[model samples]
Every structure is written in structure tokens, then in C-alpha cells.
Target chain A: MRLRFRQSLDDLKEKLLVMAGMAEQAIQRAIEAYRVRDTSICDLVDRGELAINRLEREIDQMALDLLAMEQPMAIDLRFILAVIKINADLERVGDAARSISDRVRELQAFPVADLPIDIPRMASLAGSMVRKALQAFIEADAQTAETVLSMDDSVDKLNGAAHYTLLTLMKKEPNLTPQALNALMISRSLERVADHATNISEDVIFWVRGADVRHKMGEKPATEKTGTRS
Target chain B: MRLRFRQSLDDLKEKLLVMAGMAEQAIQRAIEAYRVRDTSICDLVDRGELAINRLEREIDQMALDLLAMEQPMAIDLRFILAVIKINADLERVGDAARSISDRVRELQAFPVADLPIDIPRMASLAGSMVRKALQAFIEADAQTAETVLSMDDSVDKLNGAAHYTLLTLMKKEPNLTPQALNALMISRSLERVADHATNISEDVIFWVRGADVRHKMGEKPATEKTGTRS
Candidate 1:
């Protein structure tokens, strides 16, 4: 029974990794859609959302079942609990991806304005944050998760810069407001993706070290939480 | 042991209600800060976040301890699981509140332009959604949870209209870009609160009806997810 339960925990982790992959891919594809101005990839991201949502439900159920059926030790308990929370965060990451694709599609209709924001660069940071957080989880390395936490400052800085640039662009060229507005929203979405990654890393820290570093990760990414970055 | 476990469940529920109250109060206070343009009230919202975050950790830890130590019945297990998810959602509602307060503080510095969006109306709706969803959790009434689900559509529409009005305002008055951009972010944050409320109701439904009505919640509030409501 103990061996079977161990296998079950392993299965749960494997499922989460799958969900994480789908979420990362969605973010990447959505950004690719923006880079190339392709609506077809937006459709793919939309479909990808359905799969991610389905996997989310499945993984959540598996985690709950593990807790109900198996008597896990403290460390194992924390691991399972972390899996549940991380599952939700990953699903939100998928939501962020879908929001980005939606923005990408909207900007497609308007002639692409050369907004002074590097969204793909911001997105890449958020994506790597997700990847590193998951790696921290798989390796059970609190230090690795700590690295993910520190990396969030860079993403938050990028988001702040993007927010300032886009707002300035809107003020200067009112005609570009539509595209700039969408771009701002996309930056916000990527910022949210990074926030989810930060949350995941916090959960990993909790699971591996039994130490909670939430809100302590940094002042809630002032730009992400509060509206006044200016 | 069974009686002890029952008491633990009751304890968990009561603690959640307290956390729920903190989150609900935070949302209302944040909106009031915006309504009155009071920066001091924003300080309250910020401090309130710390309390909410602390409660979240406490409740999550209690749920985990219960699961590890007690042999909860199927229904009881589901109840604990729902509480865990709801705790996370309520924390996010607090986050939305903090975001609103931040925007309010930012907006206060600018000349109050009578933006056409009805933010208080939308916030009241979102707050009531949180209230009703918690009521459903208390009563174990899936129908009450269902009402919260329907209420999300209205909030989503309000968010959509606000998005449109704000974007148009930005286009017409380039000078108002700063205020309008902040307003737009505020509306998005409230929209997220509604989304969080929607998620809590879905968790309540899962608890009471053993249903998974997620993604199936009226097409993911197109505006909240896909961003093409223009």
C-alpha cells in the first residue's frame, strides 16, 4: 500500500508537469501570435485552454483523492497540498495566456503600431519563471524556488516599464490608443503570468521547506497589485 | 475520533467565514476609498491584506492537518477540500481589493474626470457575488451557488461596457490617458474579483452537487478571458 501511494504521488507530480507544459506552451504561442500577428495561433491557444482546464480538474481530483485515501506524512502532506495550489496557479497561467491571445487577435485587426514595449521579452521572463518554479518543485530544491522568487523582480520591472511606455504612447499619439491599450493589457497579462509563477515558487518553498514566503516574496509586485506605478 | 473530526470541520468552516469577512470588508473598503478618494483608506486596504494573508495561511494549515490526522468521510473530505479552494479564492479577492485601492490612490492625484463607467455599481455586484457564494457554502445550497454563477455574467457585461467606455474616453481625450488607464486597470481588477467570486461559487457547487461546472461557466466570461469585447 505504501508503494502504491508513493506511485500515486509520483503520478500526481507527473500530471502537474504535463499541465505546466501546456500552460507554458500556451503563453509562448500567444506571444508568437502577437509577434507574427497570426489569428490561427490564437485559435490554437484557445483550444489549448480547454485541454489545460480539463487537466486541471483531473489533477485536482487526483490530489484530493490522494489526501482522502492515503495517510501521508507531514512532508508528503505538504507536497500534496502544494500540488493542489500550484495546479490552480497553473490554470490561471493558462487564463493569462488566453487573455493574451485575445489581445493578440484584437491587435491583429488594427494595423500593428510600433508600440515601445517588448512584450515577447516580458513573456519570456514570465515563461522561464514558470519553468524554473516547476523545476524547483520537481527537484524539491528550495534554493531553486528562491531563484524563481528573485527572478520576479525583473519581470515586474519589465511590466512597469511597459506600463509607463504604453501610457506615454497613448498620450502622444491618441490614434494609437487602441493598439497601445491592448498592448498594455497584454503586458498586464504577462505580469499576471509572472505573478502566478511567483505564487508557484512560494508554494514550492512551503512544500519543501515548510516555510511560507508569500507576500514576503517582495511587496506584492507593486505594479501588479497596486495601480500606481507612476 | 469521529466527533473530534466533526468539530474540526466546524472549526474549519468558522475560520473560513472569518477570513471571508476580512476579504469582503477589504473589497468594500477599497471601493469606498475610491468613492471618497481617500488615501488613508488605501492604507487600511493594504493593512487588511496582511490580515487576510495571515488568515489564509492559518486556514490552509488547519485543512491540511485535518486531512492528515483525521479520517474524514467522503462528504467531509469534500467540504475540507472546498474550504481550501475557497480560502485561496478569498485571498485573491483580497488581492483584487488591494489592486483597487492602489488604483484609487493613483487616481486621487489626478483631476477627477467623471468617467462614464459605473464602478461602484459593478463593485457592489462583485461584493454581493462573494457574499452570496459564501452563503451558499454555509447553507450547502447548490442553487445559491448557481445564482452566483448567473450573477457573474452581469458583472462580466459591466466590465465589458466599462472597458469600451474607458477605451473610447482615452481616444477622445488624450490628456485623460493617465486617469483613464488607471480606471481601466481598476475595472479589470474588479472584473477579476468577480471572476474570483465565480470561482468560489463553482467550488461551492462542486462541494454540494459534486459537479464540475468550471470552463462551463458560460464560456469563461469572454471579456475576462479573451479580451476581444471591443
Candidate 2:
């Protein structure tokens, strides 16, 4: 029974890694769809979303079964719990990709505006954050996860800059409201992707260090609730 | 030992109920702040967020300790797992409240517009959804939880209508872009509050029936993975 449980744990990790790959690819494709204004890439993202959703359910079931049968304790329990939360974050990343694709589809109707927003750059940064966070999870690397936390600030600044730029473009050329809105929405989606990546990294930190570092930044000092061991 | 375990479970339920009250009140005050355009109410929401965050850590620690010490099985284990998820959702609902206040702060800078969007009405509906969902959770009434699911559609429709109206207003009055954007963001925040409520309801359903109804809405049919008993 113990050997079987070990095998199941290994299978769970492998499934999560595959799901992460799909989520990362979907975000890349969604961004490419936005860059080149290709509707076909949007279709691909939609298909990827379906696969991600299916994998999410399967992974969740596997984790729950492990808990039920093995009654995993200590680090094993924490790992399973973290996987559940990371699974949710990855699924939300997929949703972000689909949302970006939806905006791309809307953008297809309008002539591409030469707005001063560097959305491709923002998308690239957010995509790399996702990759790094997932890498941290697979390797249980707290240092990589910590770096992802700092990278989130860059994405936020870029998102704010894009927002201001898009608003200015709308005011300067009121006729471009629809196009500007679509661009603004795409930037917002990328920011959301970045936020999910931050969430994943935080989960990795918690899984590795057993410390809840969430809601700690921009606040006074750290008053962390240390994860107690049994 | 068995009696102590039962008491711990009861304590967990009570703490969650208190936490739910905090989340619901924060949503209500946030909506009221938007309706009255009161920064003071926003401050109250900010304070509520702090308390909610603190309680989240405490409750999570309590739940984790219960899981580690008791190693609960079957329905008891399911209940603890559900509490962890619901606790996370309530914390996110607090975040939605904070985001709404952030928009209100931005809106304070601009003149109020008598736009066609009924944000107060939508906020009221969303607040009620939170209340109903929490009540369902406390009562363990999946029927009430099911009602919360249908209510989500109404909130979604209102959010869509608000988005279109805000965009039209922005185009018609270029000067109103900032104010319109703030209002649009508040509407989106309220919509998120409603989504969190829906998530809580779905969790209640899962806890009661051991069925995962998530991502099952538009699928062929529900293929629930039964909660296997040990």
C-alpha cells in the first residue's frame, strides 16, 4: 500500500506538470494571437482551455483520493494541499488566456491602432513569470518563487502604464474607443495572468517553507502565521 | 478524545460563521460607499479587510491544526477540506471589497454622473447573494446554495448592461472617460463579488453532496466523482 501511494504521488506531480505546460502554452498562443491579430490562435486557446479544464478535474480527484486513502501527514499533506491550490491557479491562468483571446477576437473587428502600449512585452513578462513559478513548484525551489514575487511589481507597473496610455488614446481619438477598450482589456488580462503566477509562487513558498507570506507586502512589517507542524 | 474532536469541529464552524459575517458586512459597506460616494465608508471597508485578513490566518491555522491532530476521515475530513476552500473564497470576497473602495477613491476625484447604470442595484443583488450563500453554508442547505447559482446569471446580465452603458457614455462624452472608467471598474468589482458568492455556493453543494459541479455548467452532463469512503 505504501508503494502504491508513492506511485500515486508521483503520478499526481506528473499530471500537474503536464497541466502547467498546457496553461503556459495557452498564454503564449493567446499573446501571439493578439500580436498578429490571428483568430486561429484564439481557436487554439479555446481548445487548450477545454483540455486544461479536464485535467484540473482529474488532478483534483487524484489529490482527494490520496488524502482519503493514505491520510497523508506532515509534508505530504502540505504538498497535496498546495497542489490543490496550484491547480486552481493554473486553471485561472487558462481562463486569463481565454479572456485575452476573447479580446483578440474583438480586436479583429477594428483596425490595429498604433497605440503606445507595449502589450507584447507585458505578455512576455507575464508568460515568463508563469514558467518560473511552475518551475519553482516542480523543483520545490523557494528561491525561484521569491523572484517571481518581485517580478509581479513590474507587471503591475506595465499594466498601469498601459491603462493610462489606452485612456489617452481614447481621448485623443474618440473614434477609437472600441479598439482602445479591447487593448485595455487585453492588458488587464495579462495583469491577471501575472497575478495568478504570483499566487502560484506564493503557494510554492508556503509548500517549501511552511510560511504564509501572503498579504505581507505593502503592509507595515511581517506578522506571518507560521505553519505549525504536528 | 472523540468529544474533543467534535468540539473542535464545532469551533471551526463557528469561526467560519464569524468570518463570513465580516465578509458580508464589508461587501455591504462597500456598496453603500459607492451609492453615497462616501470615502468614510471606504475607510471602514479598508479596516474590515484588515480584520478579515487576520481572521483568515487564524481560521486557516485552526483548520490545519484540526486536520493534523485529528486526521479526520469520511464526512469529517470532507468538511475540513471544504472549510479551507470556503475560507479562501471569503478572503477573496474581502479583496473584492477593497478593490471596490479603490475605485470609489478614484471616483471621488471626478464629478458624479447620473449614468443609466444602476450600480447600487447590482451591488444590492451581489450583497444578497453573499448573504444567501453564507446562510446556505451555515445551514448546510444545498437547496439555498442552488438558488445562489441562478442568482449569478442575473448579476452577470446586469454587469454586461453596465459595461455597454459605460462604454457608450465614454464615447459620447470624452471628458467623462475617467469617471466612466471608475464606474465601470466598480461594476466589475461587484460582479467579482457575485462570482465569489457563486463559488461559495458551489462549495457548499460539493460539501453536502460530495459532487464537484464546477466547470460543469455548459458541459454534456455532470460526471461526479463520488467521494469514496474509507
Candidate 3:
């Protein structure tokens, strides 16, 4: 029974890693779609949702079965709980990617306007936060998770700057409003991608330290306080 | 031991209901903040978050303790799992409220230029969804939960209309772009609140039916797809 439980735990972790990879790839493709003005890449992001959703259901069932059969105690229980929460966060990361893709598709209808925000840079930072958080989850490293938390502020600043610049662009050149609105929405989606990354890191901290540091970042924690700040 | 577990289950339900109330009230208050254009009310929405976060921690700890102690199986296990999932959704309902308040605060910075979106109407629909989903959870009524699922389309339609109108306003009036953008973000936040409500309903169905109906809505449920859509 002990050996079976350990193997199931390993299986759960593996499935989550797979889910994480799909989500990360979806975001990368979505960003690429935005950069290259390619709707076909956006279609790939949309097509990828089924596999992610299937994995979500599968992972959730696996975690549920583990809790029911294994009755894992202490760290084992925490680890499964963390996996469940991170699974939800990763699914949202996929949603954020899909949302970005939708915005990119909308952008395809309008002529490309040169916006001032560096979207690829912001997306790269958000993507790295996701990558680092997953590494922390794999290693159960609370320190690396904390590093992911600190990176959120930089993404938030970039999103804020993006928000200001996009709105200014809209006010100055009304012709660009369509593309600018799409860019603004895409920026918000990336910010939420960072938020999901922050959430994954917090879940890792909770799992490793058995501490609920979700709202411990500041007054209320940016994850819950102002998640859609762009 | 069985009696103790039953009592603990009731305790968990009551705590969740309390969390549900706070989330509902926060959304109501945030909408009121927008309706009245009052930043002070936004501050109230911000302050209430601490209690909401505390309850999230306490409820999660209670659920986890119950899971570890009771070793619940079958429907009972599903119920506890539902509680955990619902707890997360309620916290995000709180976050959605806070996000709306943030936009309301930003809206206060600009002069009140009446945009085309019927925000109060959209908010009312979203709030009703939350209330009904909680009602279904309390009663374990899958039918009521399904009704909540259907209500989501109307909210989505409302949000789509709001998005179109707001963008048109920004394009036509240029001067109203800031206010229109704020309205756009607020509409998106309400849409997410509806999504969370949809999620709660799905959890209720899963608990009662033992069927995963989350992504069963369409090709993919809007809750996990296009969640941040505006």
C-alpha cells in the first residue's frame, strides 16, 4: 500500500508537469501569434485546450483517489493538496493564454498599429515566472517560490505602463483604438498569467513549508488583492 | 466518530456559507461603489478583504483537518472535495469584487463621462448567479446549479454588448477613452464573477452527481476558457 501510494503521488506530479508544459507552450504560441500577426498560431492555442482540460480532470481525479485511498498524513497530504491547487492555477494559465490568443485574433482584423508597450518583454517575464514556479514545485523549494513572488512586481509595473501607454495611444490617435484595445486586453491577460504564476509559487510555499503564505506577501497580497491590475 | 464527522461536515458547510455571504456582499458593495462613483465605498470593499481572506484560511484548514481525521469516502469524500473547490472559487469571487473596486477607484480619477454599458444591470445578473449557486450548494440541488449554468450566457451576452459599446464610445469620443476603458475592465470583472459563479455551480453538480460537468457546457466551458474576456 505504501509503495502504491508513493507511485500514485509520482504519477500525480508527472501529470501536473505535463499540464504545465502544455499551458506554457500555449502562452508562448499566443505571444508568438501576437508578435507575428498570425491567426493560425492562435488556432493552435485554441486547439490545445482540450488536452489541458482532459489533464485537469484526470489530475483532479487522481488527487481525489489518493486522498480517499491513501489517507496521506502531514507532508503527503499537503503535497496532494498543493497539487490540486496548482492544477487549478495552471488551467487558468491556459485560459490566460487562450484569452491572449483571442485578443490576437481580434488584432488580426485591424491594421497593425505600432503600440509603445513592449509586449514580448512583458510576456517573457511572465513566462519566466511560470517556469521558475514550476521548478520550485518540482523541487519543493520555497525559496525559489519566493523569488517568483518578487518577480510579480516587475510584471505589474510593466502592465501599468502598458495600460497608461495604450490609453494614451487611444486618446491621441483614435484610429488605433481598435488595435490598442486589443493590446490593452492582451496585456491584462499576461498580467493574469503572472498572477497565476504567483499563485503556483504560493501553493508551492504552502506545500513545502506547510504554511499558508497566500495573503502574506503584503497587506492582502497582490495575487488576491489586484489580480487583474492591467 | 461518525457523529463527530457529521457534525464537522455541518460546520464546514456553515463556514462556507459565511464565506459565500462575504463574497456576495463584496460584489454588491463594489457595484454600489461604481454606481455612486464613491471612492470611499471602494475603500470599504478593500477593507472587507481581510476578513474574507481569514475565512478562506480557516475554512481550508477545517476542511483539510476533516479530510485527515474523518477518512470520508464516496459522496462524503466528494462533498469535502467540493468544499475545497468552492472555497477557492469564493475567494476568487472576493478577488473579482476587489478588482471591480480597483477599477472604480480608477474611474474616480476621471470625470464621470456616461458610457454606454448598463453596469448595474450586468452586476445584478452576476450577483444573482452567485446567490443562486450558493443556494444550490446549500441544498445540494444539481437542478438549481444547472439553471445557474444557463444564466451565464446572458451575462456573457451583456458583457459582449458592453464591450462593443464601450469601444465604440472610445473611438467616437476619444475624450471618454479613460472612462470607457475603466468601464470595459469593470465589465470584464463582472464577467469573471459570473464565471466563478458558474464554477461553483459546476462543483455542486460534480458533488451531487459524481459527474464532471465543468467543461461539459460546450466544446469548453467559458469558466476555464476566455475567463478574462472583455
- Per-candidate alpha-carbon RMSD to the true structure: 10.1, 6.1, 8.8
Query: On residues A105-156, what C-alpha lDDT tens digit does candidate 2 reach at each position?
Result: 9888778887788888998999999999999998889999999999999999
Q: Give the DockQ ranking, best first.
A: 2, 3, 1
Off by over 4 Å in 3: A211-230, B211-230
TM-score of 3: 0.91
Model 2: what TM-score for its first chain? 0.90
Q: What TM-score fits each model? A: 0.91, 0.88, 0.91
Off by over 4 Å in 1: A211-230, B211-230
- Residue B162 accuracy (lDDT) in model 3: 91
DockQ-based class of model 3: acceptable
Q: Can you tell me the CAPRI class of model 2?
A: acceptable
Error of 1 at A153 (Å): 1.5
Off by over 4 Å in 2: A211-230, B211-230
lDDT per residue as tens, model 3, A1-230: 67877887999999999999999999999999999999999899999977888899889878877776745665677788889889988998899999999898878789888889899999999999999999999998999999999999999999999999999999999889999999989999999999999989988987877644432534542232122222
| Winning model by DockQ | 2
Q: Write the per-residue lDDT of candidate 2 for residues B104-127, one digit (tens) a residue.
A: 888888898887888889988998
